[model samples]
Target: MTSVKEQEATRRLMVFLQEWDSAHKVARSHILDNFIKSNDSKTEPELELEFSQGASLFLARLAAWLRMTYTYSTCLRKLLRSIGIFLSAASGHRYLIEFLEIGDVLILLEILGLNYHKEEDKRESVKLLQLIADAGRKYKELICESYGVQSLAKFLATSNSAEAQEDTQILLDSLGHSNPKYQNQVYKGLIAVLPCASPRAQQLALQTLRVMQDVVGEAPTAVVEPVLGVLRSTHLQVQHEAIQLLKVLMAHQVRPALLEGLVAFLTPSCRKELTFCSETAADTATLGLKEPKLVYTQQAAAAKIVGVLAKESAEVAEELIQMKVVHGLMVAVGNLDHVASQRYASISLEYFVHMFPFLEECVKNALGDTLFQHFMDSPETWYTKMDPLQAEELASIVIDIP
Candidate 1:
């Protein structure tokens, strides 16, 4: 049996939805005023009741307007936009959140991602996302895991409109900044769309990956291969974004298998040529080339793998060195020609410095003279307040000739 209050609320929502053209303006103002009053009220139940009534009415109006090929009126559209902002502002209001069903949240998100046709409407969508983003961890997983992220990523990947793409990325990135569970799920969806994704989609994916590092801390080794695949993309911008993502991953450590992959791709021989392949076609008045295919070198692919390994503890580092990465970075750095060839050469050296006291002999043979000084000079920056002399001395001992 439906509660009396729910039945009454439903009636009010229907009235608002039906008389939107005439009553929406008055209804919108009444809802806004009620929201303000409720927020300031001492009674929690009153606040909840007030917010639920206003939100339901606003949602009804939006749903009715969206059902038609054209909006009912400009006032209705503006009211819809205002409601989105109100929800965003009321994000932290416990009452407002409780009043929001999953269906209510989805309605707002759909407006942001799909329903809005005009640029102004799209901007309203961004405002809605911004509101949810502002809600932080509170409603993050609620909005994200419920297929909201997948829909947003799909829109971002397929939509050619620049404003829509930008809004989608902003929305996705904001959500990605939330809880780790949501970030991981959203990232998986983003990556799943990679094959047919446009340059914009790929760029957004990379951006999302960087932000996700905050949520997930260091990215796991599992992300290495897919991230490397991005690095090998034919689009220059995609490559640029991939490298940016790689830099963030490198801040952590790397795993052995991942390190091997980085070492292989960053080798000198792999830099011989650009690896993308493009085929051109001639139209009546123009010639165009489709986006080229990615060609992975054992080297570019290794960068992400190396980064994953670099985030591990000393024991893991020692184990990986035992597997030959210590020699690989040394070889890459020693050969000036190969220094630039390795995408993460400097980063590898930084990771190597941590292993100095434990693996003095291995470092001595690998790091060499000039590289040793650079390490000594830059030692303090990476390790915080450790004594400069200690750092330099360690560098000297480790990078000394075998």
Candidate 2:
């Protein structure tokens, strides 16, 4: 059923496919021309079935060229752009499988790191890689084997494009899940993004890091500093994401850094006494927090993090006690005007009271005898006092109520 004109086009495609190693750019471009559009008079299935040995030869040839070329060019970009088009058709699933075999996954990842390409070009590469990554874990591990994780982190940290950064974040999230072989590398790569210049990257990194916690085996000692460094971020979401990551990544070495970071958020006097590894982080902690209530909000969040950590591990509870995390919790409970700070701090203190029993007095001291009595009788009431904003901001651990 191949039409005369269609057969001629297919002949040219077969010739181009045969001369792939030496085919001129114009011939390559023309073959890819109308084929890129799925709505062409000749559909992918038709071209694929009729183009002699199948249309995937086009993909194989393209991948071979991408692997061999070290330089970026208009032709390369067009080829890269055409990849997604071909790889998306209904018949494209097999091509996705074939792409990994051709080493295009590695080549696409390398494009993310190369300097000559525009961020858009890099994103196209990311999109293609993301398709392979999205296929499932086997494909994801192939990307990891190709050093996909390191290249992904570098892109997230360096790209000025938010869309590109966010797209890479999704790729990383997929890569990190259940792929234990590469998770630690993925973890390190994301942690490196924590201190990068872009808050967008930092936020994206933290978001992905939160997903990685249950899978990543041991929290590396070097991770503690960069993880703590994010606490000083002006973006509350970034700070909150860091706190979420700490809940699972809390190693013995992490104990003191977390305590110090939490204490720094409590009071101006306390903040001045503490210093993070970065001068900018220290400065952001010291000078960035001017609003009094915002400081109270920070206290509430810290109290919540401490509460969760203490509830989970006896070792963590012991560390918090040694660091006088009780005093910080007490400070939060004393901020009565902010219902969130008082309730979260008091709830946090209950973890210590129940676990260590010695910190009951700290709760009584901060909440007074009457409130402390009610707090012990029914802790759920403290959760109720949280208005919608308070609950949304500070209640990641608390149950959602209508």
Candidate 3:
């Protein structure tokens, strides 16, 4: 049924393929050069169409080629480059689906697990997998069924490159969104990458966790310690992101360790005070302590988390009160040096007052007459100057005053 023109075209295509598989590097290079040159004017869709039309032939060749161990790095790179190009095209998914149909998904995933492959090659493989997953929901589900989640997690845990880790995080986030059943695996993957030396990975992990928090549920207790450790990170951005994640976790249920960690931000001297109390026993019992230096940003974050947790349940409020968190908020609001911390403290105090009105005497006592009088002097101005949400909280307090 083949026309003469079709048979002639097929013959030339076979010739090009033969040259690509030549043992001589020069012959392979020449063929690849011509292929690239011929495709220079082609758009991705055009390239996709060209590849799709030749899918059966190219896929069969690729499978045999993948089975052979390439002695030449250049040959392997060229082959990977060719596959990468196919996956990168706008209609790459068409070829990807066809490849998946023949169980080539495992072959691609195998390349990701191969220690012998160059990181560049492995990254390209991951990209191809990412493209397939991005193609459609069914592809994502197929990936999950293929244990793609575990492979990606293993790579994310071991990969040295931040860029690779970030790309992996994005892929996992997308896949997690598509397949809720695999979300726990996704959560574990994010947690596995959290302790990586790369700040970007840590940030990405935290960001993905924040988005998936509802499905991920309360973070495993194992992660709580490490996440708390990130709070002390010298990088402000990492600290801020970590605080954001902690806030999310706190909103679900107050973790004692996390609350303790946040309280450390508010009162870094607590450990020293406890140590001194233990060391000196009766001698230091009556010692007057100086206020610890407060990092305003951390103070604000701690106060916001406390406010959120306090409003969540009466039991949490009672726990925070037992930890004397209210006194810390009082000290922060009373500190006139930092307006932001003052606003955060005011917000936390309003939550406490709303939840436990009997705490008014505690607040008034903690502020003392001097600071309390100052707060009352221009309460309206103070409320108006705060962020609208905080301002609303403060206004409510004013309205509730007898």
Candidate 1 least-lDDT 10 residues: 277-286
Clashing pairs in 3: none
Candidate of highest TM-score:
2
- lDDT (tens digit, per residue) of candidate 1 on 325-371: 55454434333322232335446656665655555445544444544
lDDT, residue 288, model 1: 37
Per-residue C-alpha lDDT of model 3 across residues 258-352, encoded as one tens digit per residue: 77665555543334231111211111211232223224444655666687767766777787777777666655554455566667777776777
Weakest lDDT window of 10 consecutive positions for candidate 3: 274-283
Q: Give the CA lDDT, 0 to 100, for residue 24 in model 3.
A: 65
Residue-level error in angstroms, candidate 1, position 295: 2.1
Q: Whole-model lDDT for model 2 versus the true structure? A: 0.69
Angstrom error of the Cα, residue 216, model 1: value is 0.6
**Model 3 ranges with Cα > 4 A deviation:** 25-30, 33-53, 67-78, 87-94, 101-107, 110-119, 135-138, 145-147, 157-162, 216-223, 254-257, 264-319, 327-402
lDDT, candidate 2, 1-402, per-residue tens: 988987887787767667655657787666566555543344467657656546787777777777776365656666776677656656567777777667677678778878887888788888888777777778888888888888899899889899999899998888888677887888889988887767789889988877776677556677766776665555777767877778767754566766667756544334744334354433233455444544555566666778877887887788777776766665555454667666777788777788766566655654546656777887735544434553333322221111
lDDT of 2 at 23: 59
